[model samples]
Target: MDQKIKSVFDLQQKYKFELRKTDSKTRIAKLKKLKQALESAEEEIYVALDKDLRKSKFETAVTELFFTYAEIDHAIKKLSGWMKPKSVGKTMSNLFAGNKIYYEPKGVCLIIAPWNYPLQLIMSPLISAIAAGNCAILKPSELSNSTASVIHKIISNTFEEREIACFEGDAETSTSLLKLPFDHIFFTGSTAIGKIVMEAAAKNLTSVTLELGGKSPAIIDDSCDLKKAAEKIAWGKLVNAGQTCIAPDYVLIDEKLEKEFVSHFTVAADKMFFNYGKINDEVFGKIISEKQFNRLDGLIKKAVIEGAILEFGGETNPESLTINPVVLTSVSAENSIMQEEIFGPVLPIIKYKNLQNAIDFVNSKDKPLALYIFSDSAKNQEKIINETSSGGTCVNDVLVHISNPNLPFGGVNSSGIGSSHGIFGFKNFSHERAVVFQSKFGMTKMIYPPYNLGLLKWLKKLM
Candidate 1:
């Protein structure tokens, strides 16, 4: 094993017991310290994020820092109650026994976060791991080196290496870390890499929480407010340049509303970014890397070449690593843009005659991380909610569902596996142990191997 890997194992062994035995107060205190560290380093974090992804200060505050703080506060407030053993109802078989479920720590854990929303992804899961009384090794995506460096510095400064450590490297380093046996692994990235992480965890029989991404869709019905839907969809799609996992990848709209929806969406995009002619740098963000930019550019180019209408914005600036917010019409399911998750500012608007067509189209694809419906009709919402399955769903909104710490955020099947956020996150990092305290004269004694006629009669009567 590499020295770093060996060190991590040695530290985990040394600290696992202490972590598991940590009182609620100690855990809260640790969380508070982490919270304070983040506050003190807020400016540095903003700078790092801007350097890495060109995230504006306001966006950084809302998307990264504020979200993490909410998780911390939520964990701190709920940790005491979460740590207390829950009493369970007794069964007839344990008539004289007391039963309870204890939430125990899952020992050393690993959190592999992605570059998109880098800080929040890592810190949110780490908060739960800490609250659940587990030592952790956080591996931030190396693509966001500036943010990763800042995170490493803050965490190392606030926490002892054994208590919480940050590893920095590329895919090879992550592969090396995955070779070690961690009690649990929490991964957030593409489905392709999630598979690799799961396979590695299987080698050690490690429990895993994969927060992978797929092409989440947004359905707009005629009963809904078209302008409002366009605004929300545009906001969700343009934020982080639509690199977010749950951002609306495409729009499924009623065939009649297609022209109106595009017009409204164009207006909303222009108003949100205040860019009428050229791309605006202040409100918009650049792609994280040249490769990602090229990939997005290629998708847009192929869609246009295949005779799909570019409703608006297919301009790309290789030097700035930016692609203007794009809207496409006349897109088919087999179109290159529709074939994969478009983790960019490209939104394909597909026309459907009715609600069932929209639902059918979504179901035909791999289950998505999120399903969005922009309709005021309660009947439609209920029908869609019941018929389809996803990691999460939001009605009349986009991306805001993830802001609720009370809601468990994750994906299903190809989208993702396992949930996280607030108590769900705590449970993910914990093992619920069922405990039973038996009385000296337990009923089991009567049912022991030496069964007599009288005992058999009593057993039959009980049955």
Candidate 2:
């Protein structure tokens, strides 16, 4: 216990570090090590997530395990190139000179992972931090005890604590951890708590990257492939029991196609629940916990009282944290469910008379991390993409946008401030140092100081 406490202190003291000398070979080797650890401990990881979130083995594999390993693979394959110096274009005034931007590790960083995507949230940022060559301290969500412990065990057992440390605790401990001045802080969770993290970070003026969730609206144009759209939305919303931030918060569709949309959606749900002939043992995953369960339960009751039509799977199973997916129709804007982030297996299908109204409704709320529009029409897709100011946009897909490493992940307004993933992720955790080399002979001096008043006046005007 004493050693652990001391280690934490050491981690906090050295909040900034130059991770393994920014060498291409070294960076590649570290990413490979992370991959090996993840692959070797696959079963262990799945079991832990299952124990904490009552997560299905399949959900565990899809949401957390695979994504993390893919990020690691991406980092290993691209770290060498990303670490290379980028040549910057010279300004008109400095035509003869050269300027380049160099990426440098921003000392020590603190990554606070939320309970929803415990492993993925924590590890995804780590891939970038490692590539950027920064020592990091990761704080896993205390709510997900099993996964947190597994992460703590693996990180502690496999790597040196100084280079990367995993601290496990409740809110108080997390608050204590935040007191340390880190060079950069990356957080993923609700906007309410995201504000708290940002405020705490302000004490040190540390740069922060927030990945908060908002009401991300998915628009289904009239020309869309309804069968494909319904199938994708159902799968995404129910995955991990709709705990995903990018899961279709709510879907917008043409009022004429409402019934058709509902039919396909129910069918997709049935197919997911009763996949093949066998019941998909882990089809609709469990709600994270009873507190979360109660929160969602309240919304369901309120919506029901407010005259929202409910379909299948709204019942709660405490033993398994299993709350059946609830498909709500005729849900109006005034309904209680519409007021909050329905972070459960509840899909509220809203109908709009015009596409502009759908766009207007989304704009009225806080800016979302992602905006997904399923449309076959090029014009409609362009309209949504061009009109909305979201962090990321997917033309015809749902959560699949997040899978693409080429795109940066983050929210715009209330959703979040900074982005992560790919090059965006590396730059988020590291600071790009602008470098300009000058010669000792000063050959570039157009007006050297001979105490000339005329030269001083010209330089002032130029500046």
Candidate 3:
């Protein structure tokens, strides 16, 4: 481990006990200062995002900045309530004891954020960690170096190193950070890396909250309004050039509606990301890097070779590192594109004869981070939701579910572990310590070691 990094970790370890004692007012004030810093660095953020991911100013504001602001605001607004001890129901066995759950900081924490939505991912969990009164060390993805630099600036300028610190580097930096016994580790990134993080955390018995990604699906049946659904799906998939964790990796549509869906999807993409039939770089973002670009490019090529038709958008601009929104039709479940999370502007349309088949198909693979069901029938929605398990779900829409801070956002199994956002996020960084206030007289006395035969009989009968 680097001496500097080790020193920072030691500083935070020594400071964690004090940080855990901070009140909601102190935390809120810190959040407010963070918000102010974010405002001050808004232009720098935009420029950094543009340089790193080619994100437009408006898109940056909405997807990245807006989410961060909302999270901070939500935490500030709900911190007191969330900090209050939650009373738990009492049972006859403990009739004289008042049970409650007290939220406490999980000491020092390490937050590892991914490249995609680099700003928001780091800030969101940091907001939760601060709200929960934990000393945090942020490790932003090195792939998104520009945005990471901006984040380091914001964090360094706003907080003390002992209370909150940001380290900027490649996997080496992350590996060194992970070696420390952080009380909790919050990570948002690919499943492969998520596993690595989990492994490291296990060495210290460190608790972890992994926001990993999988091949989240969009199931569109005939019942949905094709045009409306197409438009929403287009925006969701192509907004960040399909680099979103919850972006529909592939569309499972009613077989008969494939043609109509393709037409609508193309129109939707063009309208959303084109001007005068030319690509609109402003509304759309470029692929993160040359490596990611080549990977996506390979997926599209392999899928076509294996018989999936390129329905729309396979054009790539190497110089700009941009791949236009791709739509693949007649895609097989076994296609190479379907094998992994296509974190790019590539959408494969797979036809399904029956809704049950679609559900079964999804079940055959890893549970997704998100499942999108675009159907009007409540029965259909209920059926899919009931039969399938995902980290989260959206009905009749797409990624908007993540915008609501009131909802918990995460994945299941390979997709992710644990949840974040709003109160759920605050709890993720907190330890729910169970507390009980016992009275002088208590029912538990009867169950003490004396084990009187008559009292045992009475307790057994009561149970």
Candidate 4:
């Protein structure tokens, strides 16, 4: 641990108590400053995201910048209500006592973000931390260096070091930060890295909220409108060139509709990405880096060698770090591509004989972060939802569930351990301290020590 980094941690530690005592007005004011800072840095954010991921201005604004703004606004609107102590229902044990769960700040917090959606992943948790009155330190991904630099500048200009700070570095920086004992840690990245974060936090028994990724599946029921389903999936999967955590990793559809679905998907993807028969460089984003491009390229090639058929879009331009949306068909369960979460613009469509088979196939893998179903049939939707487990689900749609701040965004088990967004995020950076005010004469006094066997029996019966 560098002395300067340790000093930063020390400053936050010393200031956590003061921060925790702040009123909702104070926290909301801080959030407002952050929102204003983001507004002032809008153009810089666009340029940074474009340089880092080749993201279009519209995409950057919609996915990253706007998301951070919305989260801050949501926190401002709901801060007072969220901060109030929640009263628990009356019970025998708590009779004559006021039991409330107080939302206390978790002191100092550490936020480790991923390269994809770098701004939102880092800022969303920071908004929650500030809303809950906790001091924080942010670690942005090194892969997205341009975006990271912009974030560091914004944070530096908008906040004091003790209240909020952003550190820009690689894995070594992350390892050093994990050595400290922060009250809570919020991480967003792959499951493998999430495990490392969890293991590090375990050393100090620090609480954690992991927003990790997994192989989220999309199911196309026979009853669904093939064109609509294809369009929705195409937009969701290709929005960030499929670098999204909850993007549909693979699709399961009936063999009968496979051909038609592929055709519709190709048209939808082309219309969205290609500008009237030509590659729309502005609308389409390039891969983040050559390293990532190579990984995706190799996956496509390996899948093909293993008998998977490339139905559409397999061309890659290494110089530009962009791979056209590749669609694979006849992909088996054992294909290497199927073994890992494909965090790229590649979509694999697997044909199933029946809905039950699709459900079974989804269940065979680790529970996904999201399970998307494309169907108008209430019966099918309900059945698929009930039979499958995921952190969240979208019916007849994709990716829009995250837009609702009222809903939590996260995963389950191997996918992730905790939740974020809205009140869920506030609670993630807070400790639900149990506070009880006992009345002068409480029923619990009857059970306090002494051999009152007869009285104990009577109290037990009463309880």
Candidate 5:
């Protein structure tokens, strides 16, 4: 094993019992301290995020810092109830026995977070792991170096090395860390990398919670509020420059409303960016890297080559590493833009003759992390909700479902494999161990090996 990994493993092993024995008060205190640390380091976090992705303070607060604080508050408020053993109903066969399900910690855990929303992804899972009474190792994505550095500093200052250690490195470091036998692994990244993490975890039979991305779609019916839908979709897509996992990748709209929807969407984009005046302004974020910019550039070029109409904002400035929020119309399913997950500011609008065609279109692809429906009709919402399957869904809105602590945020199948957020996150990091206490005078002796007519009659009576 690598020396660094071995040392951290040894530290966790030495303190595993101490960590497990932490009372709810101690855990809550730790969460409070973390919240304070984040508060104090707010400016540093903003600077780091801006340096990494040109992310503005408003975006960082809403998507990263504020969300982290919310998770911590939720965990602190509910930790005691979550820690209490739940009583289970006793069966007739075990009338004198006490049955319960205990949420036991999974011991040492590893949290690998992605570059997008770097701080929130890493800290959210860590909050649950700590709340569940487990030591953790945090591995922030190297791509977001500035944010990763700030995170490492914050974690080191706030937590004891044995309690929660943060490691900063590249792909080679992740490869080395994965070889260690962690009790649980919580990863958030692309589907391709999620496969590698799962495979590595399989070698040790390590439990994992994968938060991955896919081509999530938004459906707009003629019965919906077009202006409100347009504004919300614009915000969801433009936030993080449309690098969000649950952002509307494409739009499926009624054919009759296509022209009106396009006009409303264009107006919404103008309202969002008109004041900023340029793509490099603070209101808009730059692509994370030159490579990502080129990839997005290629997709846009291919879409145009294949005869997709560019209705608005397909401009790319490589020097500034920014791509304006793009709206493409007349896009076919066979277009290169729709071939894979477009984790950029490109939105493809596809017109459908009927609502069933929209549902069928979504079903034909791999299940998405999120599905958005912009309709006010109760019947339409219920029909879509019943017929479609996704990790989560939002009605008349986009990207806001994840903000609710009551909802379990995760993907199904190709989108992802496990859930997170709130109590679901706490349970994700815990093992529901079934514990039973058998009374001294149990009923088992009555049915033991005395194969006679009298015993058979007794069994029949019990049945």
Candidate 6:
């Protein structure tokens, strides 16, 4: 084999053994140290993410720091119970023996995170890996290099090289790492890139949990309160300049109430990020790069050419990668605006003649990572909850479904594969081995058939 491949294999073998060598208590203490380092580096992390994507201190704390700290804190509290082996009842055949299922940590897991919520994406899975007693290798996005560097410094200082390590490099380094064998791979990013991660892991038949993004839909029913829906949707759209994977990508509003909803949305936008709101700045977030900005720019161009009216931000600042909060109206399903995930702060209002049409629009897309339905009506809420399938759902709130640790965060279909978070997150890195114990019943000697056809017939009848 080539030298590079040899080196990767060596690292993988070494890490796998290291993973099995550490006890759960040691791993938990390592996580505590990492968490303390993160807390100590809070200011540095905030500034770094801001420099990378202009993320605001509030947004950083809410989306990145808060989430990372929450996961760490939750794991610290529950690791003992979560790490205990699960006992199972003995079956009829296993009546004489004890049977139990153990949650053994899979050796050496790899986590690849995206740029949007750089710190959280990387650290959250790292939390799961540590909680499950597995060694982890964190490969953060190079697009958010400043924050990646800060993460590197904190983790290196806090964690032992074997228990946890941050690998800093570009796409080549990440791709190279993927080629190495991993016991489990947890990736959070775009579906396109997720496919590559899946394919690489397949070579070794490594299991994976993909937390990917798609055009997650938001439906505003006529029964919805325009004020409440507008406020929640506006906050979802404007946060981090709408770069979140779970952020509402497009909207489905009742046609008769569309104008009222848009007006309320305008009011809410003015309230959330007006001239005095401090949301739009180098301190707040920006689009990740010129390439992504240009992509959103292209969609805006297409919308304008198709006669779509801009209700809010119509253009982008390419120099600094800042895109103003743009709301579009007079949008059609055929327009480019409705084509795919507009990952920036651009929300398109899709008018629907009926609530079912809104449901159809969401159902038409692949199962999303997250879906939001804003309605006070029990009937409408029940329809959405029963009719659609997504990784998670939020009622009357946008993107709050992910906030609950009771729910697993992931997607289905093209949006993503597998799930994580909470107990599910820790178990995703665990190998659940099945065991069966057999007991010799009263008739164990009856199986021996030594040229006795009549006796065998009697035994079968008795059984």
Where is model 3 more than 4 Å wrong at Cα? none
Q: Which tens-of-lDDT digit does each residue in 36-147 have in candidate 3?
A: 9999999999999999999999999999998899889989999999999999998887788889999999999999999999999999999999999999999999999999
Give candidate 3's whole-model lDDT.
Answer: 0.92
Clashing pairs in 2: 15-108, 16-107, 16-108, 17-107, 313-324
lDDT of 1 by residue, 115-175 (tens): 9999999999999999999999989999999999999999999998888999899998898
Clashing pairs in 6: 54-284, 94-437, 313-326
Clashes of each: 0, 5, 0, 0, 0, 3
Using all chains and alpha carbons, the TM-scores for the candidates as numbered come to: 0.98, 0.93, 0.98, 0.98, 0.97, 0.92
**Candidate lDDT values, in order:** 0.92, 0.82, 0.92, 0.92, 0.90, 0.81
The superposed Cα distance between candidate 2 and the true structure at residue 426, in angstroms, equals 1.1
- State which candidate, 2 or 3, has the greater TM-score: 3
Candidate 5 ranges beyond 4 A from true positions: 452-463
Per-residue lDDT tens digits for candidate 5, residues 292-365, read: 89999999989999989999888778888989989999999999998799998899999999999999999999
Q: Write the per-residue lDDT of candidate 4 for residues 253-273, one digit (tens) a residue.
A: 988999999999999999999
Better of 3 and 5 by lDDT: 3
Alpha-carbon error at 311 in model 4, in Å?
0.7
TM-score of 4: 0.98
What TM-score quantifies how close candidate 5 is to the native fold?
0.97
Report the Cα lDDT for candidate 2.
Answer: 0.82
